[model samples]
Target: MGAPFEIGYVFSFLPKLLETLGVTLLIVAGSLLTGIVAGFLVALPRMYKIPVLRTLSGLYLSFFRGTPILIQLFLFYYGLPELLKPLGFDLSRAPVLFFVILAYGLHTGAYAAEMIRASVEAVDRGQVEAAYASGMTSYRAFSRIVLPQALAIAVPVFSNLVIALLKDTSLAFTLGVMEMTGKAQTLGTLTQHFFETYIALALIYLVISFTLEKVLLAAEQRLKRHEAREEKAGRSFKLRRKGSYRAVLADIDAGKGGRL
Candidate 1:
């Protein structure tokens, strides 16, 4: 029979699991940074419709987004070294953590690429044309006009991506990286308290996810503050105009009554 359920073990496992939380965060942060840079590079080809590069970027996005992340991790951790051996660039001895970050980054890049492209396209074409007509160069117009709106649109999606990445980091333990999940596994095995250990782990993840949501929500609100204000002002203006029109109609009816 399995070990009896120990509610106390859940509390006991918290500190040990927390010790490895930094590693999980490290993986997320590293992967997020790498994904952003790679995603932008990948997105450019498609955005500009570069001939060969656009095709290549599409294949890249398809491959990464199509495959499961766990498989991608294995490919990077195991298959990459073998593929590189013929090129005289050895990666076999590289740390597992490196492979984990790389795989996660590439996986994240595929999603981020789509997010970035869509956000950029969602910006009004007229605004960009107006910028160009006003003596703005292509780079200047994009930087000054398109990029801000695109970033504002992308923030919410990026926040979601980050949260997903945080959760996905649990899979990194499959590669033997001693992140929080890995630590939990070890604790569970040694104590034979799988139930409590996982409960503790779940609690940790829930708290982290909650905190991230709050922070990212604040950031999203901050970025869209101007848009919110503009929308509010627009609504107010419409209401005022409607009220004035109603008042005018009421005055005309009263004048007709007086004449009658």
Candidate 2:
């Protein structure tokens, strides 16, 4: 007969699993940092329609997005070493965690590039025009005006990506990394309690995902509040401009009448 479910095993394994949580988080954090920077670089070319760069960026998106992440991991782990052997540089000697970061970062960056492009494009053209009319340089205008709005739009999407990447880090176990999943697997095998171990693992992931969702939601609300203030300020400026225009018109009429 199969062993009955033991709730105790779940609790017992929790600490062991948590011990490796740092590795999992490191992989996620490293990958995300790389992804954000790479994604932005990829996005700029596509955003500005820089012919050759745009094409290359599109191809990058296609190749990364088209393939499964597992395949990408394999390619980075195995194929990369083989490719580099001809150059007298050995990739195998490097840490597996580094390749995990590379694979996931490339994967995340492709999707992030598109998200960034969409968010930037979503900013109102009038906002850009106003920035230019205010004598702001292109870089200054974009950084001050366009980027703020685009980031607010992109934050929710990026939050989702964070959760996805967190889950994807489980695949690192396949590369022999003793991350959360790897630790869980060892505990489960030793204890002959696969179900309980997995339940604990799932709970850990759920807690992290839920916490991130809440944090991101709060950030979104704050951005909305800031945007509301900007809108109110804009209306006040328009009203003051209208009042000034009316006063100028009254003064011009008074001068004309006196002359007549």
For model 2, what is the error of residue 79's alpha carbon versus the real structure, in angstroms, after optimal superposition? 1.1
Q: What is each predicted model's overall lDDT from 0 to 1? A: 0.88, 0.85
Worst 10 residues of 1 by lDDT: 236-245
Per-residue lDDT of 1-260 in model 1, one digit per residue for the tens?
34899899999999999999999999999999999999999999999999999999999999999999999999898899999999998997899999999999999999999999977876778778899999999999999999888888788788889999999999999999999999999998898899899999999999999999899889888877877897787652211112345334532425446331
- Candidate 1 residue 172 Cα shift, in angstroms, is 0.9
Tens-place lDDT digits, model 2, residues 5-29? 9899889888889999999999999
Give the residue spans of candidate 2 off by over 4 A.
229-260
Ten contiguous residues with the weakest lDDT in model 2: 235-244
Clashing residue pairs in candidate 1 (N, C-alpha, C atoms within 3 angstroms): none
Candidate 2's TM-score reads 0.86
